[model samples]
Target chain A: MTEATFDACIQAILKGDKQGLRDIYDAYLDYIYRIVYGVVGSREDAEDITSEFFIKLWQQADRYKAGSGHKAYLATIARNMAIDHTRKYKKEVLESFTQESDDDVVIEPVSSDNTEAEVIEDIAIKEAIGKLNPKEQQIINMKILSEMTFQEISDILKCPMGTVTWRYREAIKKLRRYGYYEES
Target chain B: MKNLEKEYKDQIDREVPDLWSRIEAGVDAYEAEKKAAGTAPSSTPVTETPTNITPIRKKNVISIITRITAVAACVLILAATVKVTQRTKSESAAPAADAAMSEMPQNTNEPENIQHAEEASEATEAPDYISPITEAEADAEPSNSYKPIAGADSDKNASPSLSPSESAVIKDPVTFDDARDDLLPQLEALGFKLIKDFVFEDSVDKRSLSDDVISDDIDIRVASFTDSKTSDKYYVVYTVNDDGAADILIVRKADNTGDILYTNPSYKNK
Candidate 1:
């Protein structure tokens, strides 16, 4: 969202208006969801955390400083919340959820009646992303889907900007090698 | 690359379920919990009416209690005055009656009455006694007043026991190194030890009155030490005069006021 619009939404949230929170959630849900999904690597867990992320935003709306970059603020909070969730739950729980989703994906029928171009593209992209490691996937999601700058990603990751750019370059190279990029 | 990014964003958007309902429910629950705890800011006005009515009842009960206390106080004052008058009359009449009267209350009631009267008179006279000191304090308050608060960290730096004249300044002009060597022993003799030596060039910007302390053309060195005996911090400024002799200046760093104690007349330094 634009800075002015975000500030207005924050003012409304501070005044205990639910519509303000809804406006923020509507504007940034896809961006926040992608960042959370990137870190947790599970759709169910991402949805749950993304839901909690808005609740946190509603609760901490007063902490939003005016004229500070809102996208970076949201990205930092979302990334930290996702990391906290992963640390709170054991590795085996997340793995079991991923394994169950993978089993569902394998068993689902892709017949001519139900198969569409978008579904096929979605499945193809999902499988291509599945091949990339979690770090590379996180960088790709933050860099492309959330439209975050390398400096912001580095700040949230607490690493050097050069390392962030290098990792993003490596992830893009790996995606290209996987034939995920379409040639013009 | 743009097409691939667009595809990924669209897929994630399709996958992320709408959570506005859950969020609204959570917000409602949070507001409800805060309202139950009486901490909800928006609900405070609604709750204030009932709270405002109960204080009226409490005020009545408090006033009644205060009236009873005032009556008891008046009765006690009358009893003390009557006893004081009786003791005066009996003491003037006969010394034998004074011994009998002192033994009558087991000597407790007389002393307690006298103590209560003294305490009441002191309480009424306290403002009169403190007013002169308060005026003096107000007059001295304009300049950085040296009164250190009790139990404050600044108490470590403010030594009320040591007068400013007690701070030692080397009288004769000596070489910079020689003066510094002698200055440490002199201050140590006065119960001070070296804390740190600060570079003169770096500390020039730190002092507000740098131009008054030393001329820019002169070479100088600065060292700080604390008087362990009096808990005062002192800074020794060693400056080489045009005659090839160093003039020493001692400044008190007590409470960061940077008050100069003694300056040498040989140099244009304060």
Candidate 2:
């Protein structure tokens, strides 16, 4: 959805355009999926949470305030929903992550030519992302995957922008230590 | 700004399986449940509003409902018009339909009201069926128990006393309402959404399709003359979401459907 369409989209959604919800979903699904999947570190739990997250979008579209960047707003909802899901099924999700093990976490060097598709290497990055605290994980993912600005991250997190950028910086250093950084 | 998006963007993280469709399914289920419960399902929004809807938002909600109601009504009328016109096309049906049309109380009823009054009047005459031919015939087919309707108003002469004969049809003066709800979905299913439908009081080439009638696919056409040659034309307009891209379709009144003249991608990306 375009920035200009926030009001129209919200109104259409409330008015029962499942397509309107689809439009919002089209715009932010990957972004939200990235956030939740980054944090949960399990594709299954992430899928379940992302599905519930948008089901929430349908039942609660009217709650969306006009003029707020829907990306930031939706990312926050996704982040919170994933956190709640992990907390509820913490043992199961953690056990699965630990069992998968961090042997995949050894990231390969970023090739000067960045065209290689990394299946295991991507898992390494996700596993590396999984190690950060929830807040740190979210800040970095929102910035990178969601293309959210530091200010919007701060607004969604309700923290200082300085803290958001700093946490993202620290998260990157941590991921680099985990061998996830692309030097090129 | 150094970022992971460009570097790892192309890297294959296991892409979620067509995630939107799954989310769409979830929404469909929620809506289905709300419908089954006899209460409308409200969607979930990311920003949390209080449990109680704010008064201003409440008004917005009411307006949304009203718009939907209006759209549904318009679809009903459009569907009715399509049915009646299509019925009139069949062989040997014209004279009776002419009777129905003449019997039609053209006295100031809105198109919808005229439609309902026609259907109600038709219902009074032919009590067996109220729906259109395809729908009725679908049920009527392969059934030994069913009797085919003789004419559009087969029972007109039988029910002499209740007849909405010329005078009675006039006396009742059924009033049709003009408002219609959003039929964007139906329009989309028809292959496009009508951004506008209207008669331009002046040269239409300069005027765009009116947005006021977003839900109305009602076709309006007029014949005029600049010298002696007749200048008759028809048009349809459609808009796509996001890009605000629209296409003006030149449609013939003989058929409600239109072909895309071309698309104007001017609505978005400004």
Give me the TM-scores of chain B across the candidates.
Answer: 0.26, 0.18
* Window of ten residues with lowest summed lDDT in model 2 chain A: A113-122
DockQ measured for candidate 2: 0.15
Candidate 1 regions exceeding 4 Å error are A90-123, A133-135, A146-170, A177-184, B42-270
User: Which whole-number lDDT from 0 to 100 does residue B153 have in model 1?
Assistant: 45
Q: Which one is best on lDDT? A: 1
Docking class of 2: incorrect
TM-score of chain B of 1: 0.26
The per-model DockQ list reads 0.21, 0.15
For model 2, what is the error of residue B62's alpha carbon versus the real structure, in angstroms, after optimal superposition? Answer: 19
Error of 1 at B30 (Å): 0.7
TM-score of 2: 0.35
In angstroms, the error of model 2 at B103 is 84
